[model samples]
Target: MKKMISWNVNGLRACMKKGFQEYFEAADADIFCLQETKLQEGQIDLELPGYHQYWNYAEKKGYSGTALFTKEEPISVRHGIGIEEHDTEGRVITAEFPEYFVVTVYTPNSQDELKRLAYRMEWEDAFLSYLKGLEQEKPVIFCGDLNVAATEMDIKNAKANEKNAGFTKEEREKFAVIKEKGFVDSFRMLYPDTVTYSWWSYRFQARQRNAGWRLDYFMVSESLKDAVADAKIHTEILGSDHCPVELDLEV
Candidate 1:
């Protein structure tokens, strides 16, 4: 069994101060992916003895970034989707392993008033195409904070957030295309009716009230769907506003 975990740490440096190390160690995931690292090249030197680290940092300091730690060294690694327009923010990291290719992404959010919605739409197309291209060579396991609630069940107050950034009609429609392209949302496939979320707003005692959104995900190739043993939302183990989502596969 191969255990994989994904977490949007929000900011790696800040999360580290809040017991990220302890949780990371205890989880013991074979492949651990992180989004929203918010660090530069030399900002931090993390020491994970058994795991090799790969990171992609945005050109702007202390902004979007991603990291991947895996027990086994990857055969090859790619930092971005190769689209210069969308590559500026360090939002993607793909590692090719023996049996599968793992891609961790921190999708850009459509900020308030749907500010970045246009660019987010372009990203959805380009990123999905990139994944399909990789799937031609091997099975893919892509996971991270996708930044949208694809359905009403994915958010606590769907009606209230209908026109909000993450729950907008455009954004949700884009998310639905992912599964239509032959990928399986591992967690939803396992627990289609489970009303759980990985992220919550810090305001209004959202986490305590269980008012949250399932912004993070673990999606595998359609061919790999059967190999997925278990998918979990580890809300109990938290450091940032988002908790870790886990997947166990028989790869």
Candidate 2:
């Protein structure tokens, strides 16, 4: 089985201080991924005994970023899907394993009041096209804080936030394109029930109240569905406002 875990630690230093490494070891994923590291080169180095690390650092330190810790080094590693504009945020890391391509992303948020909504919408188009290009070569396993909730069932009070950035019509439609391209959202595929969430707003004591959103996800080319054994959201494991999401694949 190929087990993977992804989390937006908020800040690497902050998360490490709050028992990040302990959970890292406990989860014991073959491919462990992290987002929003918010650091640059030389900021931190992880000593994961059996894993080879790949990091994509934002041009601006302490900003958007991502990393992958893989037990098996990829035959090749690519960043940003060759999109120079998106590369600035260091949001994507693609690792080519023998059987499939694994991509870890920290997609751009539209920001407060949907200020960057236009850019984020453009992002969805470009990103989906990129993933499709990749799938043309091999099956793709894409996981991250996609920053958009694909369905009304994905977040608490979804109707209340219908006009919000992540749940807006444009965003949802773009995500629909992913499904149209034959990618399966693994977690939802396993559990059709609504109200399961991976991220919560820090304010209003959201996590404590279980008032949250399922913004993070794991998706694979539909052809690989049988490889999916399990998908999970570690809402009970807390540190950042967002918890961890995991996937188990027979690949």
Candidate 3:
């Protein structure tokens, strides 16, 4: 079994001060993925002894970034989807193993008032296409802060959030298209009725009331669905507004 954990650290430097290292040591995941690191290269040097680290940084400093750490070295690693237009934000990193490809993506948020909704749609199409291309070579286990609450059950107040960025109808349809393309949402697949969330707003005492959204996910190709041993949301662990989500695969 291989244990994988994905978290949107919000800011690596800030999270480091909030028990990030302690949690990392305790989790001891075989493959750990992070999104929204929000730092340029050389900003931080993590001292994880047994893992090989790979990072993709945005050209614009302190904005968007991603990193992956694995106990076993991958055969190859790629930073982006190979599209110049979409590659600039450092939103993705893919690692290829013998049997499967592991992708960590920080899907862009449709900013306030749905300002970035149009670009987000384009990204959804391009990103899904990228994943499908990888599927042609081997099964995929992709996870990160997808930034969408896929279903009504995924958000605390679905009706109120209909026009909101992450919960907008347009964004939800893009996620549906992902399902149509044959990737399975591991958490919902295993626990369909469970109402758990990985992200919470900093305002309104959201986390205290458990008013959150299930924005992060672990998605696997259809061929690897049965290999999913467990999918979890680690709400108990706190360091960022978004908590870590875990996946156990019997690879």
Query: Which candidate, 1 or 3, has the higher lDDT?
Result: 3
How do the residues 99-194 of candidate 2 rate in per-residue lDDT, one tens digit apiece?
A: 899999998998879999999878888988999998889999999999888888887888899888788888888889889889999998989885
Span of 10 residues, lowest total lDDT, candidate 2: 79-88
Q: Candidates ranked by lDDT, best first?
A: 3, 1, 2
Q: Best candidate, lDDT-wise? A: 3
List the candidates' TM-scores in order: 0.99, 0.98, 0.99
Off by over 4 Å in 2: none
Per-residue alpha-carbon lDDT of model 1 for 1-251, expressed as tens digits?
99999999999999999999999999999999999999999999898999999999999999999999999999999999999999999999999998999999999999999899999999999999999999999999999999998799999999999889999999988888998898899999999889999999999999999999999999999999999999999999778999999999996
TM-score of 1: 0.99
lDDT score of model 2? Answer: 0.89
Segments of candidate 3 deviating more than 4 angstroms: none
Q: Candidate 3, residues 229-250: lDDT per residue as tens digits?
A: 9999999999999999999999
Instruction: List ranges where model 1 is wrong by over 4 Å.
Output: none
Give residue 62's lDDT in candidate 1 (0 to 100): 90
